[model samples]
Target chain A: MREFVPPSTRFVDLPDGFAMHRGGTLHGARIAYETLGRLNAARDNVILILTGLSADAHSASHADDPSPGWWEAMLGPGKPIDTNSWYVVCINSLGSCKGSTGPASVNPRTGERYRLDFPSLCIEDIADAAASTVHALGFERLACVIGTSMGGMSALSLLARHPGIARTHINVSGAVHALPFSIAFRSLQREAIRRDPHWNRGHYDAESYPRHGMLTARKLGMITYRSPREWEDRFGRARTERGLRTTDEPFAPDFEVESFLESHAHRFLRGFDPNSYLYLSYCMDQFDLGESCGSTTGEALSRMDLEKALVIGVETDILFPLRQQHDIAAGLSSGGTDVQFLPVDSPQGHDAFLSDPDRFGPPISKFLSVG
Target chain B: MREFVPPSTRFVDLPDGFAMHRGGTLHGARIAYETLGRLNAARDNVILILTGLSADAHSASHADDPSPGWWEAMLGPGKPIDTNSWYVVCINSLGSCKGSTGPASVNPRTGERYRLDFPSLCIEDIADAAASTVHALGFERLACVIGTSMGGMSALSLLARHPGIARTHINVSGAVHALPFSIAFRSLQREAIRRDPHWNRGHYDAESYPRHGMLTARKLGMITYRSPREWEDRFGRARTERGLRTTDEPFAPDFEVESFLESHAHRFLRGFDPNSYLYLSYCMDQFDLGESCGSTTGEALSRMDLEKALVIGVETDILFPLRQQHDIAAGLSSGGTDVQFLPVDSPQGHDAFLSDPDRFGPPISKFLSVG
Candidate 1:
């Protein structure tokens, strides 16, 4: 939601091991994360970030290496998140592979790769792990739990499941409830992954896994994640290799968009786990915050004891249009919550959370400063 | 592009044979066309219609015991074109079925099936054939020639190839120039046809040609022919046999849009000629008027001697946008031709030409209103 520019960060061993939805519990879960700015004497300036699908908790900084974190530019020092003043936590999600327990991790029971043996996980379990990580750091309540896209869902879920644990909550580019169209797009992505020949029904050796499936899934996901207008502006029938393709045509890519997809998917395959991808994606699908709570969105908001809520939306986000944000805002406002709804105008589409920092950074800074 | 509700019409056969592009060759080519309303004296009320890739000259009326024409509703009596007064002749282009020489026709060369020996008909070649059909009917000139999508290209080509043919021209949802993206779309469609086991590299047995290719082409074409917004509107995450698709689910068409694609493709296989589709698509890809005429659109229109022209466009027609129509109009106007441009708003995309007659029909009637 709010872009976090980090100041400084730290890594720690979760004293209370990370727990998951799967029956098999894990031991010694470590979080590779960052802390921005100076922690207040009360240790109450903490904000946690949940990453989107295929992203690790490395939301703000590079800990062990010079390789900058995914959103490091948006979160570090003088950046949006302003780690310079507030303590921020961005751990590698429990089921992620950024030095986290996942399919590639050793299964304590079998002494082998978990692979498909990993039990299906839901968003509630992810929230629990994140809460555990937060508690292990000696924090009683979070000043705010902010997330974007999938992370946004996690942020709201964190608040919903823990109830009053977060003084304030922020969500961007997602809904309190997952819509059918959004879930449908996610379904196609996972299907593309599982249908790959090398997927081995999720039992393949972690080394020789179904990379093509992941790539296709990413390509398809990319289409839904962005807009045709973006493609028109970025590519616009520009010829590259004496023709039009940029990647290894046929097998790789032809158009500039195709090439971008290839590189993006490859980057993901490097640090992400395919099985964990399924796990996280499933968790998102299971996230229906309003289902049991209430019937209408407004009714759902009334059910929550919302204190301070910041809902950020992007204008050109076709994946989840601004209407959803406005709807959430209307519901919260009707329920008398001090909600700050910031809708950033950006043609970057759904990916504007990363691309257009100038618009999102200011509102997020204002929201964080208000407290 | 005007849609017309039809009235009772007579099928007319021109006395002079239609000519192929192979120079002065009017070899027993009968012009099979349907004419509505009475031809005014000086033959000034005549509006000639040209066929697209697989379409015949039957733009409105059906021959006895015949098939319903493509633009019937929009061309009928009191409809947009109002056949009650305006004389309309839908001339079946030369290289098509439904009464024209095509792959199935017997060639004078060795008196056998033209098949592959039909000399790879180009867009200009078809334009010449259409010119012959109109001239054979004894109309020294036409009030206008309006075509949709592929037919639009043919109308433009006719003006450029057969100078002094029409007083006004309407090119709807078409490109003055075929971008590589245009060819890229065609390439994929042709690839599906070629890959069909039955196609056998364009030499399949006449009886059981590849219907699978036809289906595949249709499936892919369906995506480009409509807006994703329309698809979302029609089918939002409704499930059929599959359970509600979530983020973790497989890639199947639970939404109505996915089903629409399948059904559209399936219907295409039921009523279409695979070979004709291949040739027609290729014609569209090769439709670079400047390349075909060895000059620019302005130079070509300069030769047409047009008095008035209306370049119609569709807003959601991704295949060709309003900018393209503007380009055509600019070219024609620059050549000293009177030009009027009207953009029709329709969510049906390129198919708006056939789907939304209200947009195309009345405007055409007003343009062709003869005292």
Candidate 2:
């Protein structure tokens, strides 16, 4: 499959023979990013925004791309990470297909899509790549670095591996390492894709894409991304107008929630490359902040140098529970960083930071303004 | 693809032209069951056991079948159910493959497996079949009806439709109707099975079985059956001896939890018919006590004539959360039935009743002793 890059996305080529964290090198590789607002003369008013899995650098619309981006509500002028006051740079994670050099990208060395031939990706690699992009943008130090979900893990890695890269950090719904439950879910999702005959060891074309596998994976993800209580209130045993007998299959979508999942899964099918998904998901399961530094999670977190930090978590997020956020706060505070942990009671679960901007926007804006 | 019946199971044939709850007629349908201990001349000491999806009539070992049954720890001569004091009868659910006339059973008229040709099964049909079995045993009423998970829904239906059939009821981790979250998960599971090319619209033979689909479905079920906290304690980032690179596929099972799911899924693949799984899973999602009687769930539950009731729920059970069990208790109490709602603190989630017998057994034994 081909990469899905927005026309307005800008690129920053890595120096030749860029070394990957888990032992591999990429030649002629580049990072995709989009910047809004202008850096001040001193570049001290900059904010770097790192995203979670499946997001692109196009976080919000700029003059180049007027269309709204994924996190449009929380970005843009006068928004949470206000472009009016802070020059914001959003970098697409290295292993994603959204304009970044991932498995979907053509390998310069072999002139073929990397696919399984791509070196194993890791969270540290994604962090390092983002760090490289920061340096390439002529910034000696970022005023603040914001990371959400998987990007939260990347931010921690950046703060630890490349010390003094940012003055302050915002960790949102992120974890130092994946819990066993999350690993099991991701493992099964990868299995679903690999088991699809059309997947064919990542050699699938558009005609034989793993549609069913991707659908199943995305549906499972949708089930986990939102809280059960939210689903209960929104769709309590509600039936869909498309009756169960609409098809020859006896187990057709009957409940409204089933239809909801079907539409969401279908929308995601063509947008992502299955190989890139496998690589990034497996990378998350393998990420361990403590293991990277050869220390305990608390010890590794305590070694980071930051003036201040803000950690936000949702009460209903099953994927990255509140306790993980608490750990992040406690660890950073131990290192003499002024840390503020805000646990929001949003029923949207892990995806609350994206969907419920009202609950997430205030604290983020307040933190950046004070910084 | 065929019925998997225990050698010691007994059968009770339904009367000719037996009607199903959803709409259909079965000419030679039968219910499978097994009994232990002796019923007194008054037949007032009889207890009927209704099982959840995937269980058979062989709930516990009998004189003829020495093999330990699913509930062997809790049902025996001196066990929680205490067969020596109360004669116990365990009935295989109507649409299950274990010694019951489900989709896997042969049709009397066509001499072929019913498969998709089988009528759409409902919880009420399973309840009605159990009621028929009880009457066949010459019992006017059961001293108590014990149901767990899906069986909990069936027991409610039996008590409501066949008034005075069961004097008391024990609902374990059951719901009046499936929540949207639970429905979404079950829908994905069914999709996994149906999307398998080998399924062939339920016409798969032994050589062409949908193994991958069933494996995915079973693994998903295993993940939801237990609590995340339990997995965190049991297998936190533990790696298996088998390396990730052992297979050509990069996404192979590497974590201990993934291995746990794989072994469990493989063990279940050949034991049950895939068609039966699709039927029973859909049945559970479709079951709503309120809709069955054209009343609200609370109203339908309040109409049941029970002298005593015990509702048990595990705090961590995502499938049938404690709130659902509380509703059952409240509804039953409104009808003037003495109700005890026990919320277990076991970390076993929905399967706590099966795995944490010490916590679950005491309440069950005490309730039966006083029933």
On TM-score, the candidate that comes out on top is 2
lDDT of 2 at B251: 80
lDDT of each: 0.66, 0.89
TM-score of each: 0.73, 0.99
Chain A TM-score for predicted structure 1: 0.86
lDDT tens digits, residue span A1-371, model 1: 11122334344565444456545556655555655567899988888887777665556544444456667567877777787777887755656655556656667668877766665566656667777778778898888888788777666666666766678777788766555555555554565467555676677655777776676556556665666556666765453465343222221124454456556767766445667777677667566666534365466565556678889898777667777778777777788779988888776778887776677788888888786
- What is the per-residue lDDT of model 2 for residues B70-160, given as tens digits with 9 covering 90 to 100? 9888988889888888899999998889988889888899998999989989999999999888898789988999999999999998988
lDDT of 1 by residue, B1-371 (tens): 01111233333443344444433443444445677667988887777776555556567653442456787777767877777777888765555555655555555646765555555556776677677668767888888787777777888888888888888876777776555434444555665566455766556665767765675567657666765455556654454565445544433345455455557777656455565566567666556777678886667767778888888888877667678898888888898988889888877777777776777877777777742
Supply fnat for every model shown. 0.09, 0.94
Error of 2 at A90 (Å): 0.4
The alpha-carbon deviation from the true structure for residue A162 of candidate 2, after best TM-score superposition, in angstroms, is 0.7
Question: In model 2, what are the clashing residue pairs, if there are any?
Answer: none
Q: What are the chain A TM-scores of the candidates, in order?
A: 0.86, 0.98
